[model samples]
Target: MGIVDSKGHLYLKEDPEVWIKNNPASRLALVTSFRLNLENGVEEIAESIGELTHLIHLVFRWCRSLKRVPNAITRLHKLEHLLFHSCSRLEELPANIGNLVSLTHLQLSHCEDIKFLPNSIVNLSKLTSLTLCHCVSLVELPANIGQLASLTHLKLSSCRNIKSLLMSVANLPNLTSLSLSSLSLSEIPYNLGDLKKSLTRLDLSYCNNIEFLPNNIANLSNLTSLSLICCNSLIELPSNLGQLKSLSYLELYYCNKIKSLPDSIKDLCSLDTLIINCCDSLTHLPINLNVLHLKLLNFCPRFLPNGLINLKYLRVNICSCSDESFVNWKDPYSLQHLAISSCFSHCNYILKVPASLNQFVNLQVLSLHYKKRFVELPANLVGLAHLCLLDIQHSSISCLPWSITKLRRLRHLMLPKDFRLETLSYELNISVIISVNERHVRKTWEELKTEIGQLPIPFGGEITNDAAQNPSIMSHPGYLWLKENPSQWIINNRNLLKLVRFLDLEYVELTDSIMQFSELTHLCLDIAADICLPDNYFVTFTRLTHLSLHFFSVGKHKSITHSLSKLSNLQTLHLHMHHSVLLANFNMPVSLKYLSLSYCNNMRPLYDSLEKLTNLKTLDLYSCV
Candidate 1:
């Protein structure tokens, strides 16, 4: 069955004839939008579709057998949007499609058989957007396309047969955004500059044959963004590019042929974000460019600007540069996010933190990734009071300075996955760990039994006597039983506990102490033992939106499903369990939007449970049998 909204919008996945036969013609006249999707056997729409005079939007998606659009569709003069995607067998559009004088948007994607648009398409004077992507057979556009005076956006991607665009495109005086790619042209149309007064964004990504841009491109004074990603053959840019006074963003990724940027780039006072990554042939960067956000990967410059007062975000990766290149900043107080990483496994260079790091008072997010050379952080980090996120994963740093406890605003702390529980407990000064071995298991178990009696019963019931008596179960290396009373440091840093929002742990025993993070919105646990969660644990996390659990061994945890279903606010859930764990009766929250299950066998029993997740938009099953 299809759905009809209160505003007279109809969405149908089945044949429309079945619906029309059940409804009155008068009711159909009120429908302003109609969408038909996944009706794979549908070849043609009924000409009676023209009777819906109020129709404003029409879409046909994944109708693979559809070959043509009826000319009767043009009779709906009020139609403003027409879209067809993944209709691979679609051969052509109606020749008189322009008869819908009110059409403002049109898109056709993955329709491989489409070759050229009808010349009458120029009659759609009200059209504002036209997109034809992944139409491999499309060769040329109408020569008079500029007649669409209201057109503001045009995107033509993956149209490999389109060797060049007609010069008339420059006549679109109101066009503000233009994207072109996957073409054989070595240069853009010379007249493209004619639209300088209105063009604000230009993207030529994946245009592999383009070598150099015309100097007249500098005439686009109002342009705000320019992207040349993966344009491998491009060697140089227009020398007068700095003339674009309003330009704010520029990206040149994978353009390996470009060796250097124009010196005039320093004149771009309004530019704020610049990204030049993977440009292996690049040797140097212009000094003192006034940008607020900058990223440089795999390309190291000999020198950096002395003072970038407005810079707020900076990321440099895989660059082999001297420590001087980073500490040279004179006034870096405005920076809010900084990340530096060394990803090259064989690179011997060691990246060191700048000695003047305290100058960045406004910094909030810091991430550092290094395989082995990076060992420690500065002793005093209290200078960064506003710091909220600190990620040092994949680094050799084993311990953190005790002064880290002063970061009251620190909410997200990501450590290396292999970090030991004892080290974390000692650094945080929060827990008293208890170790149990085969010889002393009985003594420790008797003492813990009295302590467990006072605590709330855990989900999936308490540990059984037989299981507790087993030597293999009691002596598991990952287990770490803690006392109920917290250390004095935990009492003094109560605010930090309340503000923490994300935690990622491995082999850490689940205990009542975790419930203190009342504001946590994300939690990830990598469990190596057969443990049960505390009672009402998920119920207390009303704000948690993402949860991931990786179970390493199979255990008797029948309440796992009931425990997960209690999380009403969870939006994303990831479960990576051993193949032996039975997935029968597994139910997830209805609010979940993304679910990923990996390495779990016998997933057929979960089909019934998944059918109830109406809001789920993405489901990923990896290595599931």
Candidate 2:
């Protein structure tokens, strides 16, 4: 029989007439799966479920008030999966849960009152996965947990009081993934090295109390990814870490105690991405480092690696550096992206763009954001033939660089907020200038579009009048002319208004005329923090599937919500506001599948309104206070 609502009254009656009247025998022989999710008032389940002997899957997700499950459920012999995710009031599981010999997966994530798992669970030799994330009261695991030979994935992330794992945990021969993040875990069991061949990923993020990793961790030959974020007490990595041949990605963020990377890291042949952020004491990188393709070295600008000539992306915040060292820097051979910023204390000092910038022939993007310190661009930018994006904000430069006007391939440009021109000495031949003050940028963008769009037809290349009259050829000019115009030409084409499927407007005035573009599937608007959405502004885009809004103020929360409620087709919504904007209550579209909130520091504890969004599959929050 299929499961009904969690309420006791909704369960099948004792009489066979209520469920499968023709063959009542099917209840015990044929019923295979039961689900009763999102029911709020259920406190306990009826004991009559003991008759379901063939049930394979049981789910009770988000039944917030459920205090306990009936112990008689242990009678099922064929049950393979049992889940009670987000059952906040559940205190514990029945001790005889191990009676289900066929059970393979068990999950109890977000069960706030669950304190421990019964030792009887160790008897389920076939169990392959177990998860107890966000179980605030769970303190320890059974001593014989390693005896489950078939167990492969184990997660105990955000378990408040768990400090260490059992020493025998490493004995699980088939284990592949282990996650123990956001906990007070100070030490890993010494025998952890025993899972050398099976384990592949290990996460130890937000474990502030962890002082160091086990030295024998290098024995894990199959390990590929390791993360150690916000582990403030960690002083160093194991010297033999290079022994792991399969390792690819390594991240160390805010590990204040770490002084330098071990030189042995040079041996990691597969390493591709390395990020070392806010490591205060780090002053140098490993000498022969060459495995990384992308490296972000922030707050430690004094150290520059020598063999990184092949790097594709590099971002650095140099806090302490001399004029000589800054100017003598060499450009990477194929560097495509380079971003330079200074620490707050050094923001006001004059920092010249290195003359060596002209050597980066392959550079495609360059950004600088030192308001007071930045003074000029290299006099000769023509050498950077591949340059396409240039972002210069809060700089002290008095005028647009003369060489910049000659860049034929440049597509996008972002100028400082305070910039305004009273005279035009050189023509801006580029397609777009994305800036907060759109009045000036938009006007310039339109003028450039018209000038290019109205280019006279070449005398020899002119098409016949008969070809121009053909419906097929006249309907699609882009197919034949796309290569002739500038790279950004199509985006600003006058006849492309209806063809535009995506639009991003930042710091621009909101007018009713914007609603004319009914073909938009994705739209992003970033208004000023103090501005509010215009009334009746959102109903026009009935076809938008993805939308993003940024920089909201406190009073605009209600208006934002009202506008969002009209977008019934939106599948993804993102809101980014300053720390002071608080959102207490709002109505979200039932169609939304993904939602993200960033920098919303004052948002109250989100509860009821979120629970109503039953279709949401992912929710992300970043840097919220």
For every model shown, the clashing-pair count is 0, 0
Best by lDDT: 1
TM per model?
0.66, 0.61
**Model 1 residue 450 lDDT?**
29
Report the C-alpha lDDT of model 1 over 463-532, residue by residue, as the tens digit.
3224342221111111212222323323544534543444555565566667776766666677665677
lDDT of 2 by residue, 1-625 (tens): 3343333112331222235344466434656776666466767776766676667887777788888888878998888999988889999899999888999999988999988889899888889999889999888898888888899999888998988788888999999988888889888776788899899989888988888899899999999888888889998999998888888888888888999888889888778777777777777888656554555455644456677665777776655463333343454667788777766556667776665667678889988767767755765788777888888765654335547656767777666643322111234564655442222343454443332122122223323224432211111111111112222333344344454444555476565556666666666676776556676477788877777777657576466666776789877776776664555656678887777677776556445578778888767676677
* CA lDDT of each prediction against the hidden true structure: 0.72, 0.68
CA shift of 378, model 2, Å: 5.0
What lDDT does candidate 2 reach at residue 379? 58
**Could you tell me which residue pairs clash in candidate 2?**
none
